[model samples]
Target: MLAAVFHENGGPEVIRVEEMDAPRPGPAEVRIRVEASSMNHLDLWMRRGLPIEIPMPHIGGSDIVGTVEKCGAGTVRSLLGKRVVVDPSLDYDWYRLARLRGYDGEPFRVIGEHTQGGFAEFAVVPAANVVELPDGFPAETAAAAALAGVTAWRGLMTRGGLRKGDRVLITGASGGVSAMAVQFANEAGAEVFAVTSGSENVRHVRGLGADHVFDRTTTDWGREIHRITNKRGVDLCLDSVGEAIWPQLLRALAVRGRLVSFGATTGPAAKVDIRLLFWRQLSILGSTMGTPAEFRDAMDMVFRGKITPPIHAVLPLHEARRAHEMLEAGEVFGKLVLDPREARP
Candidate 1:
C-alpha cells in the first residue's frame, strides 16, 4: 500500500509518497480498501502543525469512501464487499452512553486528528463508523462530500436552529463547507446570503441557491447584508473565518440571533466588544464534526440528491502535498479529492 506521510511539520515539500503496510481490522472494526479520500482545511492545519505535536510519519485525511474488504470478529459479516463512507468522529467511553441513546456527547475525536486516517490503500475503522453507500453513488463524490456536508448540516440545523423564513449568512462562500451551508440553508427554506472573495465566485455561490452574494474583496459585506435585510440583520451568521470577519459578523446578526462557528481560517484572535453580545442578546456557538446520527441524516440528503457536492479538482493520491498547497492558498472552490487508484508510484 502506498501512503502520503509527513515526518516534519512545515510546507508541502515535507509530504512524501511511499509504500506502507496495509491496516487490518480489529474486533468491532472493519478493514476498508480505500478508493477515494478528500482534503479538508483540517488536513492543511495538521500538516502545518498546530498547538499539539502529531506523531512522526503521520498520514492525514478524514473524508474517505471505499469498499469493505474484511470485517473483524463480532462485526457485521453482511457488510463485506459493500461500498461505504466513514463517520470519522470517535466517541469517548463516557460518551458511549449518549451514543447508545442516539444523543451526541462532548469531547468528540476526529479521525486523522488522533489516529491514522484514509490516505492510503487500506484503513481500519470501527464497524459503527461505516455507512453503506447507495447504488450509483461515485466513491470520489461521497468522499468529497461527506465531511463538509455533515459539518454544514450540524452547524445549521443542530447548532444554529435554522428554520424556514430565517435569513442565513455564510462567510467564505466558495469553500467546501460554505458551499454546503448555502445549499442546506436554501433547502430548509431560508434566504441565503453568501460572502465570497471575488466576482468570479459570486455566480458560483448564487448557483448554490444563495439569494444574495456579496464580494468580500471590495465591499463591506456585512453592511451590504444589513442593507439587504433592511437593517434587521440576518437571523444566523455562519463564520469560519475568525478574526478577519468576527466584528463584521457580529454586526450582521439579528437581535437574539445565533452565530455558529467551526474554524478560524483567517487567524484566531479577535477583539470583540462585550456590549454587542448582551445588547443584541446574541448566541455564539462553536461546533465541530457531526455526531453519528447527524452524519447519517446529512448523508441521506446527499445520497438522495437533495444537495450536491461541488468538486473543484481530483488528483492522484500521491499529490497530497499539492492538494494541501491548493487548499492553503485558497485556490479551490470546493472539495479536492484524491483517487487512490490513480496515485503515483
Candidate 2:
C-alpha cells in the first residue's frame, strides 16, 4: 500500500509518498480499501509541529470514504464489502459524556492526531465509526463532505442550538466547515450571514443560502452585520478565525446569544472585555468534531442532496503534498479530495 508519511513537522515538502504495509483491523475494527479521502486544516496542524507531536512517519487525513475489505475476527460479519464513510472522531464511546459535561478525556487521542489515519490505500478503523453509505452515492463526495459537514452540524444544531427565524453569522465563509454551516443554518430556516475575503466566494456563499455576505477585505464586517440586523446583532455567531475576529464577533452577537467555535485557523489568543460577557449575557461555547450519531445524521442530509459538498479540487494521492500546500496557502475555496485509486500502480 502507498501512503503519505511525514517524518518531521515543517512544511508540505516533508510529506512523502512511499510503499507501506497495509493495515489490518483489530477485533471490533474493519479494514477499508480506501477509495477517496479529503484534506482538512487539521491535517495542516498535524503537519506543522503542534504542542503534541505525532509519531514520526505519520500519515495524516481524517475524512475517508471506502469499502470494507475485511472485518476483524469477532467484528460484525455483515460489514464486509459495504461502502462506508468513517467518522474521524475516535472518541465514539465518550462523546455522550463529553457533550454532557465538556469533558474530552485526552486531547491528543483524536484520529489522525494520535493514531494513523486514512491517507493511504488501506486504513483500519473501529467498526462503530463506520457509517454505511447509501447505494450509488459518489465516493469522492462522501469523503470530501463527512468531517467538515459533521463539525458544522454539531456546532450549529447541538452546541449553538440554532432555531428557525434566528440570525446566524459565520466567519470565514469560504472554508469547508463554514460553507456547511451556512447551508445548515439556512436549511434550518435561519437567516445566514457570511464574512469572506474574496469577492469570488460571495456568490458561492450566497448560493449556499447566505442572506448577507460581507467582504471582510473591504468592510468593517462586524459593523455591517450590526447594521443589517438593525443593531440587534445575530442570535448566533460561528467563529473559527479566533483572535482576528473575536472582539468584533462578540460585539456582533445579540444579547444572550451564543458563540460557537470549532478551530482557530488564524490564532487562538483573544482579549475580551469582561463587561461584554456580563452585560450581554453571552454564551461562549467551544466545539470539536461531532459524535458518531451526529456524523451519521449530518451525512444523511449530504447524501440526500439537501446540502451538497463544495469541492475546490481533486488530486491523485501522490499529489497530497501539493494539496497540503494549497490549503496552507489558502488557495482553495472548499474541500480538496484525493483519489487513492489514481495513485496505485
Candidate 3:
C-alpha cells in the first residue's frame, strides 16, 4: 500500500509517499480500499507537531471515503462491499458524560492523529465509525465534506444554537469549516457575515450565501458588522481565527450572544476582557467535532445535497506533498481531495 507519511514532525516537506504493508482490521473493525481522502488544517497542524504525542511514521488524512473490502471479528457482515465515509472523531458513550463534566481521564482520539489514517490505498477503522454512502454519490465530494461538514454543523448549530433569522458571523470564511458554515447558516435562514483575505474570497463567500462578506485585508470586519447592524452585532459568531481575531469577535457579538470556536489557526494566545462576559452577558464556548448523531446529520445533508462544499481541486494520492504545500500556503479556496486510484502502479 502507498501512503503519505512522516517520520518526524516539521513542515510540509517532511511528508512523503511510500509503500507500506497494508493494515488489517481488528475485532469490530473493517479495512477499506481507500477510494478518496481529503486534506484538512488538522493534517498541517499534525505535520508541524502538536503538544501531545502521536504515532510516528504517521499517515495524516482524516476525511476518508472508501469501499469496505473486509470486515473483522464481531463486525457486521452486511457492511462488506459497501461504500462508506468515516467519522474521524473517535470517542465513546462516555463522551457525552465526560464533556458535560469536563472530564478527561481518557483523552479524545482522532483517526489520523492517534492511529493510522486513510491517506493511503488501504486503511482500517472501526466498523462503527463507517457510514454507508448512497449509490452514485461522488467519492471526492463525500471525502471533502466529512470532517469539515461535521465540525461546522456542531459549532454553528449545536453549540452556537443558530436559528432562523439569526444574524451569524463566520470568521476565516475561506476555510473548509467556515465555508461550510456559511452554506449551513444560509440554509438555516441566518443573515451571514463573513471575513476573508482577498476580493476573490470575499466574492466566493458571498456567492455561498453570506449576506455580508468583508475582505479582511482592507476592512475591519468587526467594526463593519457592528456599524451595519446599528451596534446590535450578530446573534452568533463562529470563529477559528483565534488569538489575533478573538477580541474583535467577542466585541462583535450581540448582547448576551454566543461565540463558538473550533480552532486556533492564528496564534492561540488571546487577551479576553472578563468585564465583557458579565457586562454584555455573553457566552464563550469551545467546540470540536460533533457527536455520532451530528456526524450522521452532516453526511445525510451532504448526501441529500442540502449543503454543498466547494472543492478546490482533486489530486492524485502520490501528490500528497504538493497538496500539503498548497494547503499550508493558504492557496486553496476550498477542500483539496486525493484519489487513491491515481496513486496505484
- Candidate 1 lDDT over residue span 276-327, tens digit each: 9999999999977687899999899888898888889989987888998888
Candidate closer to the true structure by lDDT (higher is better), 1 or 2? 2
The model with the greatest lDDT is 3
| Every model: Cα RMSD to truth | 2.7, 1.9, 1.4
Q: What would the TM-score be for candidate 3 when compared with the true structure?
A: 0.97
Greater lDDT among 2 and 3 belongs to 3
Question: Lowest lDDT 10-mer window, candidate 2?
Answer: 104-113
Ordered by TM-score, highest first, the candidates read 3, 2, 1
Candidate 3 global lDDT: 0.91
Clashes of 1: 0
User: How well does model 1 score by local distance difference test?
Assistant: 0.87
| Global lDDT scores for all candidate models | 0.87, 0.88, 0.91
TM-score for each candidate, following the candidate numbering: 0.95, 0.96, 0.97
Error of 1 at 330 (Å): 0.6
